[model samples]
Target: MNAPRTLRAALVYFNDFENCQRFMIDLRWPDGVVRCPTCGSDKVTYLADDKRWKCYAKHPRAKFSLKVGTVLEDSPIGLEKWLPAM
Candidate 1:
């Protein structure tokens, strides 16, 4: 077995923006299905370029990020700093 990684090392792991986004996506939707939190619509598309999810439903706000509806929604801090604290 290998020795456990230190806190500093683990933090470095999350420092990568892409990894942080993937981690948050998994944490939020374990089944890997991205849905619209607003209309509860499963018909959503992954906007990779913008790093946000867009709901196909006819709504004023069709686009949203993983941060939507969560406590960290308005926080400037990313999942890189938030997940470690969990």
Candidate 2:
């Protein structure tokens, strides 16, 4: 009987929210143009204390997380767990 091949994957996951935030920031706004994800407004602000993005356009969804509008939406799991799963 041949045993099933169980592939072991070693994922280097980062638990630091800042690291994850920086990574997403780099991917979404590679040119340093941090626009509002909701309204596409370039006048967006970064709340380092809250670790989120705020849009100055006065929209319903002004404040957003790095996970907003992404595959991580509506997921309660933290980035540490999510990265490993990916």
Candidate 3:
């Protein structure tokens, strides 16, 4: 989905977890392929329960969330709140 045009719209649009996730995914991986940020590998799977991605290839940091490798990394803030502020 397109980004909200106004500040109020963004606040409403990004309130939902699913909408925030999809917005971040699209913003991060515009091509629709999620990859391992550390290894640059595309062989990854999303763990719905965990709300993160796991790289199948053996690696030290196989599991990653949307915040990994980003300014949001290590922050406790949720995307539902962060995305709208961007």
Candidate 4:
């Protein structure tokens, strides 16, 4: 019944996870520490195809994306749409 509420919900639903991830990464690791999100270890490797980082330290979630351990978990959006939204 409320147009504004519906629009707000739609926007939230359309949030871009990749862009959110990159943004969060820049915010958290501006100097490009490339640390493991799960274990806080600087030992990490980038997986370009999957866009994720792998940690040398063994953990439940050794591999993680830029959005891992952030507010954008489980989102299915892209950076192209997310930058404008922000």
Best by TM-score: 3
All models, RMSD in angstroms: 3.5, 7.9, 1.1, 8.0
Pick by lDDT: 1 or 3, better one? 3
Q: Flag the better candidate by TM-score, 2 or 3.
A: 3
| Pairs in clash, predicted candidate 4 | none
Please write out the lDDT profile of model 2 over residues 1-86, one tens digit for every residue.
12113323213424656556666677678885878888888888889888788998987989988788789979999765675565
lDDT (10s digit) by residue, model 1, range 1-86: 22116777658777887777777778778887878989989999988898888999999779999889889898998877886665
TM-score of 4: 0.65
Reference-based TM-score of each model: 0.78, 0.74, 0.92, 0.65
Give per-candidate clash totals: 0, 0, 0, 0
Cα lDDT tens digits, model 3, 1-86, are 68899989999988888898888789789997888998989999999999989999998999998899899997788887888788
Query: What value does the lDDT take at residue 45 in candidate 1?
Result: 91
List pairs with backbone clashes in candidate 2.
Answer: none
TM-score of 2: 0.74
User: Which tens-of-lDDT digit does each residue in 1-28 have in candidate 4?
Assistant: 1211444553554465544455556667
Reference-based lDDT, residue 60, model 4: 89
